[model samples]
Target: MLSYGFWNNKGGTGKTSLCFQSICFYAHQHPEERILVIDVCPQANLSELLLGGLANGGSDRLLARQGAVPRATIGGYFQQRLPSPYQPPAIEPLDYITTPCEYNDEIPENVDLICGDPLLELQANAISTLANNNIPGTDSWIAIIDWIKDLLQPLSGKYDVAFIDCNPSFSIYTQIALSTVDRMVLPVMADDSSRRAIQNAFSLVYGLKLPSDIYATYAFATRLRNANRTLPKVHMIVKNRLTQYMGKASAYAAVLRSIDRDIEKLMDSNPEIFTFEALNDGIVDVRDFQTTGVVAFAKGTPLYSLKTGKRDVMGQRVTVHEDYKANCVEHMNDLVGQL
Candidate 1:
């Protein structure tokens, strides 16, 4: 399957929300293709949105999945894999899959989900230990990293495309989640820290311009390359939460331009690690979703499914301006068009 991952080392970058909306729009636009979404974040916010957001009983539904006999979540799949860290299990991969549209009518009919779980936080330490284990005749690290890949083995040719939502940290779970992606869609805000986060992402994923020679030996790129594995190329960068302001003289304009310049310099030096040679070809500027985003996310609804004006969200009347709603859909359409 052609897979894309939405990730950034920084939080508050609107990564999950963007993934939720873009995937929904994509699923709605292409009704013939079966879509899959894997939520690897411990918070599982994306899962909640998929199942039914706060207005609906999403948390309750998620809890039911988490408490199932097989656990019925990614953590449950991890529970199966922990006992056989170095080998694939005999269990069914589709058993862990849940169709979101079955629970929430707002979702497109073709979408399926592997629910994220809070159990991930508890299992992270033990999983890390398993990865670093010194097992004879088996590469513990690669096997651990491939847990998700192995799980998806039976799903080969089953899905037209897949999207993974990762946590902000470089934890063991995040490492496993990222190993399956062919293209990386990084989201960043208009700030200096985002610039640093982009540089950090490059260093963490591709081992570009690592600070010292000693670190190269223990870097992610080092280990993956040693195992003859490939790193996902940077396909596109989404500048999320850009405030609509007074043209190029806005307060965030300078920060955004600096980030672009930094990326362009990196493109010049590490052309092999990016899908696009030019920065403009790979960058998408999205205005803040604002009221439309708040309402859409609150009810587990996609932008395209939203009607302007007052919308009921759990007995609360939330006003969704028509202009704002249309703006959200337009931005999402633009982002999906890139895919």
Candidate 2:
């Protein structure tokens, strides 16, 4: 399966929201292709939105999945791998998969999920320790980080594409998911910090422009290269939550241009780090979805499936204007088109 990882070094870029909406849109657009979503973030918000949103008992449904006999979640899969971190295990990947449509009818039938869990917060230390284990000629780090890739190997032909919603941090779980990624979707906001985040993400994932060579041996990119494994190329940089200030004269324009210039510089220096040869083809800007997004996210409904008018969301009334809803749908269509 071709895996697309959604991530950013900095938080508050609306990464998870963009990821959730993008996957739903992608699944709806490509109904013939069986889709899989892996929620690698410990918060599991994407899993909740996938199962059912705030208005539809999403939290309750997620808890039930976490409480399953074998526990059908990413944490569950990790637990199984704990005993055999360095060696391949016989556990079935499908055993850990859940059909989101089963809980939320609004989601497409072709989409499956490996739900995220709160247990991951507790599991991080153990996973980190395992990766750092000094075993003789074992390359324990690589073996530990490739857990997700190993899980997906069994279902090679079953899934056409996979979307992973990653944690903001460079957690071991995120590394596990990124290890399987063919392309990365990085979402950034319009600000100077986001500009720096672009550079930081490249440094973290591809070992580009580090302060010194002293840290090169400890970088994720270095380890991947040493293992003879290719790192994922940045496929799309989604400029998310954009406003009208994106125009040339807008005050935010300078920052936006600076962001573009940074990418342009990266393109000139390390063209191998990206999939697209041109910056325009690789970057996308998404407008703020406004109230339309509020209602859709609250109900865990894809923007395309949402209707205009007021809807009760957990006792609060949300009004989704027709124009706003249409705009959001169009934005989603444009965003997913790049995928």
Superposed Cα RMSD, model 1: 1.1
User: Over 4 Å off in model 2, which ranges?
Assistant: none
- Give the clash count for each candidate: 0, 0
lDDT per residue as tens, model 1, 1-339 = 989999999999999999999899999999999999999999999999999997787888888888888888999999998888888979898778889988999999999999999899999999999999998888899999999999888998899999999999889899888888889999999888998999899888887788898999988888888999888888889999987773687767888898889889988888988889878889998899988888888889999988788788777787899887788789889999999
Give the lowest summed-lDDT range of ten residues in model 2: 244-253
Model 1 lDDT at residue 288 = 97
Model 2 agreement with the true structure over 212-274: per-residue lDDT tens digits: 899998999999999999899899998888884467877577887898898998899989888
- Error at 234, model 2, angstroms: 0.5
Global lDDT scores for all candidate models: 0.90, 0.90
109: Cα error in model 1, Å: 0.9
Candidate 1 Cα deviation (angstroms), residue 234 = 0.8
